[model samples]
Target: MINSITQNALRALLYEVTTEPKPGLVDPGSPGPHSDMNIYTFIDSSLSLTQYFNDAVKIGQTFTGSDLTQMFFALRRKGLAAEKAMLAATHGVNTHKGAIFALGVFTCAESYCHTRHTELFTTIQAMCHGLVEHDLGHICSPQTAGEKEYAEYGYGGARAEAEQGYPIIEEIALPFLKDSTGTIQARLLDTLMKIATRAVDSNLIKRAGNIQVIDWLHEEAAAYLALGGYATDAGKQKLKQLNQECLEHNYSLGGCADLLIVTIFVGLERGYL
Candidate 1:
């Protein structure tokens, strides 16, 4: 089970990076807005986290405690090590930090769910209960980008998403991906844009230096979907235009990308992929 989950996790990581023409993200054809990392960097970073995923599954499998939050803490400790491994592999490029957090939580929750015969989302919510308050309730000084976003905008980012059991993935991305029709790349690209419509992408905000950019992003993504979303010529042109706009503004949909990764992991685990 651990090996299978780890393989899915790695596949999710690689799949997200390799999906073509993702606006403001690294792909095989372009690095989008990112000047530092590329597809090869993401591949190396993804490969380096194999052991971390293994440990996360093992933690979930062996945890016998009733308090699932305890299991979450154990996974977080492992996640720190995973982040270090990611940096070491990328030579300091932060390619998968958000993914490591979101996917680690899903990986751990999936393992626990399987062992206990519980539902996956419920297990994730139990593991991440009060996560935002616990992690960000007392903030005298902001360190990470998430902390800073919380202090400034009250946006909880990934923690809030997990604490709510990833409503975007549960309610939106998973269903859309399951019903989506296209080649694998087309399905993923459409799903990615669908996620972008709702995602309050902190990376986009950070790059644009304002939260207002989210509205524009939402509109652009919705318009792309309206034009048929990676299937129609108009939709493809919109994506190309969006990609160019993101590059020009140095924006990145990293939070949306992370959500896509988690969604893909869940989809694969549940046989929707």
Candidate 2:
């Protein structure tokens, strides 16, 4: 769970990303059929990733009013090196914290746009299917030790899903925020670690391949919120209640991994992801 401060700040940014429109990236009007509470960002990296990275550096520098931008750029060099070694995508990658921000953006997009647009929904499902194929490989394939861990760690893991694609997604997601360095940082990192473990899986094809991916993502978010710290009393209570309901239905904790996605999005929407 992200510390209250980082979580709040991240939530604020996500809200801005969804509710406000900036040039050369996502147009708030284009995604279509939006609501006051529901917001969206274009998911394709080509549209907003570079601008978002630049804007984040600018915002960070402005917030701290130091030489952090150049410092951030410098740190990015090493991150680039690390990414290259891993053969990963580096488009939106600048820091690990960016992954949280990106997830927030994804949640917003899903909540606002894709869920409503039949065309986009079909496209997204295809993208999801592609993501499953790209990240998961053949669902029916044999399991290795890594695969076994993937099957057990979160929603997809219990059904014997693989984990190769999850790390790759994480690698692509890095590089948006500064490293965790304070109490808030630790909390954010902890939250990030928890979500990172489950987010991709919640969105992937289930091991049994039976349910909507978002259903699991929502459950994961509720579980995380139920964990107490960093949440409002109401948020905590709501999540706790949801967790109980989920348990009553016999869903495993791992099955609710999408909670990370939901938590980030809902938190961002409510000004807390």
Candidate 3:
């Protein structure tokens, strides 16, 4: 039973990483998707972190309950092992670094919720409460995209998002997942664009060297969504066009990609998607 949650978590990870036509993300069938990494890198990263996900599940299942602080710490230690395995697998490429963080929390949260048979969002909130304040608030110098975005723009990036129990995922992705009627791939594709249109997406901003890039992404994604998203025939063409647009400019919606994974993980845990 404990390992089953880990396996489900792996499915969420695999589903996120392998889905194609995802604008600017590494996916199967995209021969030369992004310059820095490829589909193989993402597959390697996901496969390498299996044990870490399982370990977090075991730790969460064994936890004594109401100890979110300690659960988070244990997950972090487990996260480090995942990161090491990722680096080894990808040969130093940061394929799923954001995923490692988000999925680590999700795994721990899932473990706790499973052990207690609690609601997914409630347990996730408890697991990640004070994340930004306790972990990222004291950074003297912001270096990474998340930290720099927090320091400069006051956008907490993933930490702030998690601390708030992922408002964006709840408000945007989950609703889309529940209401949208289509195959899982079609629905997830639409939801991914929906998130792309709204998320702060620090990864896109950092890589493009400015915030305007994400703004453009928002506009482009909104326009594609306006055409009916990935559910319609025209929307499919629009999505492909958007993919070409991003690929031409070397754009990657990695931040939104992470949230997409979060959305999928939550949906899976809650049996919504």
Maximum-TM-score candidate: 1
lDDT, residue 198, model 3: 88
* lDDT, ranked from best to worst: 1, 3, 2
Ranking by TM-score: 1, 3, 2
Displacement of the residue 202 alpha carbon in candidate 2, Å: 11
Q: What are the models' TM-scores?
A: 0.98, 0.26, 0.92
True-structure lDDT of candidate 2? 0.34
Tell me the deviation in Å of residue 8 in model 2.
9.9
**Alpha-carbon lDDT, every model:** 0.94, 0.34, 0.81
RMSD of each: 1.0, 17.4, 2.0
User: Where in model 1 is the C-alpha error above 4 Å?
Assistant: none
Alpha carbon lDDT at 261, candidate 1: 96
Candidate 2 regions with alpha-carbon error over 4 angstroms: 1-126, 138-262, 270-273
State the lDDT of candidate 2 residue by residue for 126-241, as single tens digits: 22233333434554553653344344543334122211223322332122112223343233423443453344443233332444644554455545545542334654454445
Deviation (Å) of 94 in candidate 2: 9.6
- Residue 67 displacement (Å), model 2: 44
Candidate 1 clashes between residue pairs 3 or more apart in a chain or in different chains: none
lDDT of 3 at 100: 87
